[model samples]
Target: YFIIQTLAAAMILFASTLNAWQTGHWAITYPTCPLTTTIITTAIMMKLGAAPLHLWYPEIMQGATLNTALIISTWQKIAPMSMLYMMHKNLPTTLVLLTGLLSTLIGGWAGLNQTQTRKILAHSSIVHMGWLLIALAMDTALATLTLALYILMTTAMFTSLNTTSTKTITDMGTTWSASPTLLTLSMLTLTSLGGLPPMTGFTPKLLILNDLSMNHLLPLATLIALATLPSLFFYVRMAYMTTLTTPPTTTNTKYT
Candidate 1:
């Protein structure tokens, strides 16, 4: 990861230098600087953990503690995304759109096979990053809203996971004994993360889709909506384990 960061730094410098040489200045507001925009955007993509450049994000997240994972999913995103936000008017629309859609697919599809909580959330973060990218392309204000909702939902999730020491879907089963109320809330929060309706998490997706339709991005909107289902499935399964299942046990807190 350090090597990648080093390479990314080099890429940023090269892109900046190219932009300077072409325009006799270092400003990038000109958006059509060809290769310069591509390199810089790609570098930012690496930083944002947007797929297909996102493998390292999940790996690092899975190994870290829950607190660290929270930082990675929320705080770490701010700088790169800020850079992207600044340059959105100049970014290549096709490149941004394709990468954003791909991220949603990869995050949703790959997460379905996981039982580990961190990995699941890692993929969930990628999916949200996708939405953020798409929103970035459409409207920076919408992107900001998407990002804010993601941070709130993820913080809620990781706090719950950390509180109960749950590192896997199966671990969630045991946590209900520790604090059933917390576990139940965690279940709902997971659905919110999955962008289920009536939850705060659903708000960004709803607005983004509405914006997309308004702009005649019907095909893109449809694909993204379908991609959401797989992620929602895993979230629903987690909710099932935490809230729905009646684990076969015969122990009481007051065994007299």
Candidate 2:
């Protein structure tokens, strides 16, 4: 991980230097909207596990401990957003729109079959990034608010999970019976994750859709928002499995 981060930093420095030299500006002014920028940005976003480049996230999450997965889900994931913000104006609206829509669709659909908890969250992050991409494209105050809200919500969720002692889904067997309060909170968190109404998660998605619709992007907004349903379905399924399913005979009665 240290090596990976070091290499990533070096590559980013090189890329920034190249962009600045070519554009005669320090902010990546030149070729930001060209094929070069798109390829680089897309590749970086992929490395960060955002949509279209999201395949790595789930696999990595599965390999890591829950706390490590939480770190990846929160702090590490924000790099792409920062990169997008830096070259905000340079991103093509059409490309942003397409990537956002595709991410939501694929993330949601692929999450359906996943039984592992970490993989579920990995895909959920991809779905959320879809909304984030849409907000970035819209470039409105409301969109900005939505993005901030999303970051906050995700952070809160990660913190809550990190505080838990259980390291895997199997460790959480019959968790509700042992700790009903935590179980309820877990349900609430997952519900929020799916962007259900009244939760912090839903707020941003709603705001993004409204902003897009007001800007005459109703069809696109509707489609992207609807694409979230598949991810939502699986989240709901996980919630049910955790709470509704009968406990296994081997299930321990304790959370730890």
Best by lDDT: 1
**Best of the candidates, TM-score:** 1
- Alpha-carbon lDDT of model 1: 0.89
State the lDDT at 149 in candidate 1: 87
| Per-model CA lDDT versus the true structure | 0.89, 0.72
Looking at model 1, report the run of 10 residues with the lowest lDDT sum. Answer: 246-255
True-structure RMSD, every candidate: 2.8, 4.5
Off by over 4 Å in 1: 29-31, 246-256
Supply candidate 1's per-residue lDDT for 28: 65
Off by over 4 Å in 2: 1-18, 29-33, 155-173, 249-256
Quote each prediction's TM-score.
0.94, 0.83
5-111, model 2: which lDDT tens digit per residue?
45556655666777777777766544553655765566556656666766667887889987787778777766766777777777767877888898899889888
Which pairs clash inside model 1? none
Q: Mind sharing the TM-score for model 1?
A: 0.94
